[model samples]
Target: MKYAPELKRSATIALWLILLTFPIMVIQVNTIENIVVWRWMNIAGVGTVAFVLSFLWQIYQHRKTESPLPVSAHLPAFQRLLADPKLYRPMLIFIAAFALVFPFTASHYQINIMSTALIYIMLGLGLNIEVGLAGLLDLGYVAFYAVGAYSYALLNYHFGLGFWTLLPAGALLAAFFGILVGFPVLRLRGDYLAIVTLAFAEILRLVLENWNALSFGPSGISNIPRPGLFGIELTLEQSAVYMYFLLIALCLLTIFVIYRLQHSRIGRAWVALREDELACQAMGIDKTRAKLTAFALGATWAGMAGVLFAAKTTFINPASFTFMESAMILAIVVLGGMGSIVGVIIAALAIILLPEYLRVLGDYRMLLFGAALIGMMVFRPRGLITPSSRTYVFQPSEHQERT
Candidate 1:
């Protein structure tokens, strides 16, 4: 006897759920004490909920059909206003004004959090070039960020160089390293490329962790200098505000550069490469150059962000550049709609602020966050803010109309 399709699907979903949740629930680590804690109850609760939801969702989808009704055009006044093209400029002006005055009205903690969110926004924009435009699956993008941070850290620690002087230097060095990594993997794509990048990041982490003479091992570099305006050193509150403004500038610069590039010939090539590498190559687009260019440009942004991160934190460590960091940045890009600057800003804000707001959830914060991410992927796989292309209209000639 054969099982029903729904039953088979439910069983498969339940099996996968068990496999994914078992390790995290069954094996827990206490980093401070180096001990393990087991929580079977949590596992059981999560697994049961996941299985039930998956089964119900599958059934609903299977039974669902498309509606025959036409879409409604008579939206609410607020929704209509938002949809109007004429209102875009005014809306943007209002948003900019709000952002400009936010720090003045908000608490110090909120200001600091927004600053952190801006850094991730910068990172998301950088990765958008590689993964979003060029279709490169980079799991080790944080390695470039690590390079940027370490470059500044080493320069400050040894040579006593200031943040301003090292800013471009860090970006240039990271771009150079990007080319070095890109050259070897120019021909690879998809999972193979992802695996290589992941390995590259892990190698960098291990080297930093073990190289005590160079990186100071796990203890990391300390007392990194912050950016000073003119000759005066900024206080802690002043520094936070300063960083916020600096990040806004950097984010704006990123937006301008990406916008210009998106309309340029190189940008078109990148899009073609993303859509179909084989077809792009057949059309005389050099795959090697495009891939390397994307890598270099993307790395440049990550490097700049690293410099700012070092200045803000006044410390650098191997642990700061981890796989989880890469994943977070990737999620920002995906959730924001890849290649969209405005979407990236919104996604970055949500990713950074949502957790802070949900702090009351305690241990359940991560669980809820995971569930939300899953829901987003299921409902809006493309992204929350998909980019739309511009439209052009032309009038027919009088002669053609008469004919």
Candidate 2:
């Protein structure tokens, strides 16, 4: 009797889902043959799945409310395992070994996919600094990415600059653009800031798309040349291997730098600003500098990743830097757990590689992916690994002890 209301609610939800999906799932039209096919079974299937999912969701919510355990007890098992050094250290070592050997053993196609995943990891971490640490929501991070790529393409086309030379140049140019965008949005926060950043990115993309002479228009620049190794020429396969190793090195460097920065004084300022802008300002932290630094530093990694992206693909196009790219990068950060270095890496790999591996399911792969994401959001809103709180221990100084 007590469960009757819950059951009714679930039924209602299932019915709604069936009604919503009826047109798409239950009916198929053949225009050439002038035929309409009805799959009534799809209605039953939708209802059953929706009912079961909704019922399970309600039960989970009920249990959560009734449970005697503290809120911390609900932390995800993966996060708990990560907190134990005994587990995570060995896991890290094993993963590192695998990553190093992966390029050698995996097929060239797989290596390329892994390289793309690494690039996203770089992008995720960079955005983490801005959105996760600084609480600045940037919807146009791909703009900086485009800047780095196009910088390499244009400079190489006209001035004959090499990858090694343009790598740092691309990053610097992106950082300069970051500062330029940051200056206008220093006072904006939340949605307003996101809008401004997104606008900036769109404007850049439009310029590149329209400026035929400068960017070569929609055709894009091709044969941009892969990264050279000490003036030595290499075959295509060898070049892929080199690019894979280069990405590994860059990802490591990015992780190290971000980890260090996360624990630094300026990093603390960013966190404080994120938590409370008014309070942070009251504490004498320079808000303008913090905001600008966050934007520039965060964009720096994207710029570097962009250079590598252009080199690996040996091409540059405005279409590649669309809003969807930004959304995916943002999804990596959010799904991984904001402000978590390890979480972002894990999320980036999973999000990028899962679809490739699930291609066996063909069209249904994305359906499964979408369902998984929905489940995650419903069950674990904080992400796979919640960022651990900073712990400080007090130790008496020698002078105080003497006194």
Candidate 3:
């Protein structure tokens, strides 16, 4: 029978990690002497960490599988608290309070990083609509983000329009492009659709990069102005704080709108489409409308995020919205648990903060990160926050008896 599968999985992971990280961890560049050096000790340390984590994961999995009850059942108090909405409501409130007060306690560096994470959170929420809700694989969702950034940058530079005014303009323009891009791919599905969308993004990026006359080319458009609060220009720290709050508002708006849409009739239709296109068509749902709407709405949010990103950095460049960026956004969605808001937020924070915290590792940071991600996928394929919702059951007998 199958037993200790985790051990087999961990062994595979350890082997891969050694192969991937050996060269980086074992070899070092001694810039002072201009010579290449080998650090066997460092390699051993890195390998040990990877192997230990994998082995521990196996133990955790064994315990989890052996337990017949839910994972949270061991913590009776926590389970009871979660079961009671009244108790959890206060906890949620406390969490929100802490978030509101977080910047005050943290450094400017931390605040800035958090703001970046929030932007990705918005992007992840948008992409979730297509990949998670509608099951549309889009590898070039960053096109809309670039569109939004350029739209805002060009409009502001040419017309002297402020960021507040440019926000909706960017989203609308992105949504327009979304529809334009969505039309051609409506007939395509799966990998074909993904390829087409990806091509579309590359085309847009190339246009922006080469058309220096309009986009300022590879040099990028700089000196982009930041939004002010109450017509007052703030210091760098104040600006960072203001941007942080702005992101908070935008993130909440995204969450609320997506939450509403997820529970609405349109959401139900999208879910049907995702489950089985043939079955969805047989149920009388209009595939065209559902698909287009998903694209439009998802792109709209990405555009908004792009606008925020431009404003935050005060620069717009094609390099900022590359295929790597798209991959990162997709990774956040997948790692966060598709169709889960809280999961997306948590994943975004982890993706952003983990790298920052790993700065001490220097060149070895990404190696460890990739290994951790692999481990996460192996151990918790469903993601840290799995997609879950409450269900209501109706009893016809009870209704008749009551009547």
Candidate 4:
């Protein structure tokens, strides 16, 4: 499945150029009934949309001639994608560039976007561990996030603990809650499973709201401290930039850990359990341990993200950790392509960054975002970056293969 170098380069360049131009197309003009903004060039967003439509039309016109098979009129887009590594390589490069350049860009508004995007990326990774790798559908991921944030705030403000110390403790608390959630519905499956997970997440949220004496109830925690490296506080000039690097490092580390685990015995066990718990159990893989491990590990990431969130914003609220937040994180895992780290990262960025870019589009913004997501899902059901052989190859068994 190889493509010529010239075509590959062209594909990659075009894709990124479109992507890069996309964010700059529309700017928030004003907000009356709806948020509106100024456009960069002449009718910017509209022009961009027209260009994309024209491009798609050209590709469609080539259908039978350049694309294969009767059923493949629509398939060439994806096939061409898989055959060319160039299409997504620029994306990788762009992400790397952004990681290096964005923090240096002196705009508080832009920095806020970067921080939020990083937080969502962390959240997406957490969901990916549960749903993508272990095949567990978590509808209330934000519960763990809430737990982590509150844990740190309560522990630190009340007990006078430091950020470095409470960070791991936050994650551990989230994992403990994950285990609690996992245990109750250990026998549930499919819709039942989803319902239970949702229930668990809501239960936690409700508890936070009602229990005001200790948890601060609905008032939420304010003035949470920013974490400092050694004695160097991040509150100095360019604090966002400092936090940016820290987050990037943490995210990369998390990604590295996930990659290692995905290739390790525990990771394999998760996939096995995902595919068939009964069979996995018969093989003595211990379904209970594997399931709990998946829940715990996933929640740990959520907790860690909470710690970062508390530090950066220096404010906390129950609204931030709603079920909708969980849904958005799960959306990243699904929209990006499950079990594909690269894809998940893209999805996370898109979910967070796209809306900010479309602020100028105002009234039509959400409508357009929803349409684009639906359109992409319809076109690339497997996700923008489908799992390839090199990405995640299932472990084999000779007996099963023979059968």
Candidate 5:
């Protein structure tokens, strides 16, 4: 049976409902600060109560009505687009503009927040390559990040190497590490793979903390040099706002690389490997090579981000490369949609920037954040921007009929 086409005049109100229910509730939670005097525990307590009440009310309404809240109200194609941007052009411009002017804010706090956001954006895109494009569940992503940051920091500290010289080297080293990681995990799947990756990240963190001779042993390498641009050494005098442009350029370059790779021959092979490894191998696709390449490429991107991060922070500690960091990066990728670069970028922004910006709400922030994440996942499991059930329809092969 054919699915009914959406009516011409109807609108897609599903998203609006979600935004209204969760985001507006967040606004309310922020608004009612006086209702909770203790602040920290108060907000959490209040939000929890409110959520329970709302949930109970929902149950009550459903029991009484014997129906869902609302039906689908789809708009015509042109009208549907009017609510959203025209694919990625607007998003690209949105990203460029935000990255460009965000640095110019008079507030140092904003600049600091945005710098973190840019780093996460890079991290999200890198993880998107592995988990999103290749369908690999990696929990040890921090190892590559650690590898890159440490490689750059140690190289510069020991050899007086410049940031530019060490960035590529760090990426190459991370890629090497990625190959090492992939070899043993070829047979692991799902939760098992995630556990192994998590173990790897923890191991890297422990090594960094314990290896005093090489890693400086938890004291961490401090006073790291920032990247110099065009022979001009970036100093405190350069202003945090100005340095942001360098980050913007780096992000744009990362975006370009991802775009090229997504449309490349290797990208196609990775997608094939993602869909089904046995089938990919049967089709003469070297599944091993494809998986390895995906890992390497993903690691390379994270490594580069780590190099930039080392330069940006000018200090590193074992604490920064913890498993939580890996989980946060993975959360942005998964919450944003695995294969969608734009979704990852948006998720990165929301995850990093939104929490900081919402700090004005004070104690209620994390409570609202947890609620928002849960609501987002419940409403759109695929991600914030990614479509659900977009199938890759391949025509029947000559050997398929016989099989």
Candidate 6:
């Protein structure tokens, strides 16, 4: 009796969902054959799923309202597993071993996919610095990515620079562009900042598209050589293996550097700025320097990743650095959990690899993917893994205690 209202609401939700999806889910027309197929079972399925989901949602809301503990107390099972060093240390070791052996075991196609995922992990971590730590919204991060790719492509085409020479060159050039972006939007925040960054990316793309002589226009630069192994020529398969290992090393280096930065003074300043600009300014932290550094550091990773991307694909064009690329990278950071290294890595892999694996489902793959994203947002709005607060334990020296 007490649950009557809840049940009634769930029933109403179920019916509404069924009504909304009737045309799409319950009926399919064959254009070639002019035949209409009725899938009445889809109606029943929708109703059942909607009702159960709505009921569960109500129960969850009820418990949430009644609970006194903080949201962090209700950590997900995966997070709990990670929190236990006894379990996670072994898990990390096992993962590292598997990663080292994966290239040898997997097919070249699979290796390529994994390499792409690794690139996104780098991008996600870089953006984590800007959006997650510094609370800056950059919608045109791909601009720096494009800058790095073009830097390598153009310099190589004109001056015949090698990948080894261009790797650092691209990163430095991207960092320079990051500072350029930071300067213009020094005072902007929120949506305004997003708009400016997005505009910057679009402008760059447009220039590359129109500048036929400089960028080769829409035809794009091709036949770009792969990363050379100390002037030792290798077969295509061997090069793929070499590239995979290189990316792995770079990913490790990125993780180590960013982890250290996260605990440094500038990192703290970024976090403070993220929390409150006025308070951050009042605390004597240089807001301009913090913002610029965040942008510069974030773009550095993107630039490196861009060089890797160009070397791996052996092609370059403006179409490749669209707004969608930025959005997907941003999704990796946000969905993984802002300011969390492990979360970004996991989310990048899942976001990039999940769709490829889901191809078996054909047309329904994206539908299921969208549903999963919706469920994730509804349940874990904070992200798959929220950044844990830092805790410091205090200890007193024996002499101080005696005094």
For candidate 5, write residues 1-403 as lDDT tens digits: 2212222111223333334455333433435565522234434444555555455545555554775434333222422443466665675688567666655644776776777788889889998889988888999999999999999999998899997889899999999999999888888877898899888889889989998999998999999888887786555736466556667777888889988888788887878777888888898988778888989999998998889888888899899998878888988998887787767887898988777877999997887888777877875687865533335889999899789
In model 6, what is the error at residue 373, expressed in angstroms?
2.4
Candidate ranking under TM-score, highest first, comes to 2, 6, 3, 1, 5, 4
Per-residue lDDT tens digits of candidate 4, residues 1-403?
Answer: 3335434544555556655765556556455668666565634445556555655645555563685676634444644555678875775687689779876765877887888888888888888889988899989889899888988888988898998899899999999999999998788886788778898888888888888887788889998988877786545446777787888988998899998988788988888888888899899898888889999999999999998898888888787878888888988999888887878888899998998899999998888888877877876788767665446568889988999
Q: Which ranges in model 1 have alpha carbons more than 4 Å from their true place?
A: 1-83, 389-403
lDDT score, candidate 3: 0.89
Task: Give the RMSD in angstroms, all C-alphas superposed, for model 5.
Answer: 9.5
lDDT, model 2, position 383: 80
Candidate 4 to truth, TM: 0.76
Query: What's the candidate order when arranged by decreasing lDDT?
Result: 6, 2, 3, 1, 4, 5
lDDT of each: 0.86, 0.92, 0.89, 0.81, 0.78, 0.93
Model 1: lDDT to the true structure: 0.86
Q: What is the lDDT of candidate 2?
A: 0.92
Whichever of 1 and 2 has more TM-score, that candidate is 2
Q: Give the TM-score of candidate 1.
A: 0.82
Of candidate 1, the 10-residue stretch with the lowest lDDT total is: 67-76
Stretches > 4 Å off in candidate 3: 1-83, 397-403
TM-score, one value per model: 0.82, 0.92, 0.86, 0.76, 0.77, 0.88
Cα lDDT tens digits, model 2, 311-348, are 99998888999898998899899989899998999899
Pairs that collide in candidate 3 are none
- Give the distance in Å from residue 205's predicted Cα in candidate 2 to where it truly belongs: 1.5
